[model samples]
Target chain A: GAGVSQSPSNKVTEKGKDVELRCDPISGHTALYWYRQSLGQGLEFLIYFQGNSAPDKSGLPSDRFSAERTGGSVSTLTIQRTQQEDSAVYLCASSLRDSSQPQHFGDGTRLSIL
Target chain B: QQQVKQSPQSLIVQKGGIPIINCAYENTAFDYFPWYQQFPGKGPALLIAIRPDVSEKKEGRFTISFNKSAKQFSLHIMDSQPGDSATYFCAAIKGGSYIPTFGRGTSLIVHP
Candidate 1:
C-alpha cells in the first residue's frame, strides 16, 4: 500500500463490550505505532513495534488495552470491556525504521463507547 | 506528566498573515522535534522537523525555529491561507526512542 491503512473507520460499541481496531502499515516498513486521541486533546502514545523484537507496551493506559502485530505487517488493537471514557479516535502509523524516522499515519478509527 | 506544552490553544489570522505556534518541552534528552498539520477528519501529516544540532529549518511556507537551551520550538507559517486552516501539533522524541511526546494541538484559522 502507499500509506498506512486502518480498518473500520468508525466503531460504536456498548459499555463492557470488546472492540478490535486493525492497521496495515506501509509495505516493508519496520516500525509501527498506535495512538489514542481524545476529543480536543493531544495524542497519547499506546504502543510501538520494531521488527521482530518485543513490542513496547509502556503507554497502554490499562490492562484492558492490548495490541498485536501479526507477520510483521498488520496489527490489531483490542480494548476489553469498553467504557465511555474509552471513546476516542485510534490512530496507526508506520515508519521506515524507528522514531528517528518520520511516520506516516492513517485516517484513524473513531471508537465510540456508549 | 506532559513533556511537551503548546501555547494558544487556538489562533485566528487573516490570509497572507503569518501565524506562529509555540511549544516547550521539559526533557533535555529529546533531540528530535517535529510539527504535524491535520485537517478535519484527516490524519496528521508531517510539516517540518528539526534536530537539536540546528536552530532553524524551513520548507516552503513552513519554518521551525528551535531553541535547544530553552527546550522551546516554534512553527511559523508564512503567508497563511484559508486552506491552511487546521490543527497543528508539536512532538519531541529522545535520540534512541521511538515514542514521541506530543503537545496539545493548536487550531489555526486563516480568514479570507
Candidate 2:
C-alpha cells in the first residue's frame, strides 16, 4: 500500500511569492495533518483535517497560511506572500480515525524562499 | 506552551553499546507516548510506543521505559549500530485529540 506522499520534493521561490504544497494521504485514512520542520527546529503543527468536518486550523501561524482538504483525500497548503522565514520542510502525515494509531508520514516538500 | 521537551540534542555510541534518549512532558492529560525515527531524505516512521497503563515495553532491541507519574519517558536502543543513526522524536497525545504534540528531536549516531 502506498504511504502518504507530497508533491514537488523540492521547491524554490522568491520572497513575496505564493507556494502551494500538496499531500496525498494513505487510502482509507480519515485523519490528515500538516507540519513544518525548520532547520535545527522541531516539527511545528500547522493544520489538520478529519473527514468532511471543519479542520483544526489553530496551529496556522497567520492569515497568510491556509489549507483545504477536498473529497477527504488530498490536501493543499498555501502560503501567501512567502518570506525567507517560510523556508522549511513541509511535512504531511496521516493515520486512522483513532487517536491512538501511529501516523504515517510523507517525505515532505522542502520549500526554499530565497 | 510546548508540551513535550527532549534533551541531549545528539548522542554518539560505539557498536554493541546502549543508547538512551529521554523526554519529559508537562501535560498530565497525555496518555499515549510514541517514538518516531527519521533518516535523511525520508519521512519519520514509528519505532515504538507505550500508553500510560504500561510502565515499559520492549520490541526487539528497542525498549520504551515510561513513567506516568513523573511525566518522563525514555527510549533505549541496545547493541546500537551505525544503521540506527537518525533523528528520533518523542510525541504524546492528550485525550481524544487526534494531533500529537512532538518533542524537540534527538539525533543519534552509532559508530562501529
Candidate 3:
C-alpha cells in the first residue's frame, strides 16, 4: 500500500468481549507503532516493532493487550476481555526505520465498548 | 510520567488570526520535536517538525519555534482558517528511542 492501512475502521463490542485490530504498514518501512487516542488522553503509545528486534511492550496497559507483527509487514493488536475504558481510536503508524524519520499514520480503527 | 506538557487544552481563534500552542518537555535527551494535526475521524498527520539544534522551522502557514535552553517549543499557525480547526498534538522523541512522547493535545477551533 502507498500508506499505512488499518482494518475494520470501526468496531463495536460488548464489555468483556475480545477484539482484534489489524494494521498494514507501508511497504519497505521497517518500523511500526500502535497508539490509542481517547477524549481526555492524547495519543498513547502501545507498542513498537523494528525489524527483528524485540518489540517495546513497556507501554502496553496490561496483559490483556498484546500485539504481534507477522513477516515484518502486517500487525495485529488484540484486547482480551475488553472493558468500557478500552473505547478509543486505535491508530497505526509506520516509519522508514526509527523515530528520526516521520511516521505515516492510518485512518485508525475506532473501538467502542458498550 | 508525561514527558511533554501542552497548555491551553482548547482554544478558539477567529479566522485570519494567529493561534499559538505551547509545549514543554523535561527530558534534555529529546532531540526531535514534531507537531501533528488530526481531524475528527482521521488519524494525525505531521504538521511540522524541529530539531533541538535549530531554533525555528517554518513550513507554509505553520511554524515551530524551539528554545533548547528552556526546553520549550510552540506551534504558530499564521492566518488560521476554518479548515485548520483540528486537534493539535506536540511530540518529543529522545535520541535512539523509537517511541515518541506526545502531549495531551489542544483542540483548536478557528471561527469564521
Instruction: Evaluate model 2 with DockQ and give the value.
Output: 0.76
- In the range B1-112, model 2's lDDT, one tens digit per residue, is 7689997889999989999999999889888998999998888899999998999999999999998888899999999989999999999988887778888899999998
Residue-wise lDDT of candidate 3 within B66-93, one digit each (tens)? 9998999999999999999999999998
How far is B10's C-alpha from truth in model 2 (Å)? 0.5
Q: Which sections of candidate 1 miss by over 4 Å?
A: none
Q: Each candidate's DockQ score against the native complex?
A: 0.89, 0.76, 0.85
Over the stretch B1-112, how does candidate 1's per-residue lDDT look in tens digits?
A: 7889998899999999999999999889999998999999888989899999999999999999998888899999999999999999999999888899999999999999
lDDT of 2 by residue, A41-61 (tens): 788889989898999999999
Greater TM-score among 1 and 2 belongs to 1
Top TM-score hit:
1
* Candidate 2: residue pairs that collide: none
- Top-DockQ candidate index: 1
What shift in Å separates residue A111 of candidate 2 from its native position after superposition?
0.6
lDDT of candidate 1 vs native? 0.94
lDDT of 2: 0.92
Better of 2 and 3 by DockQ: 3
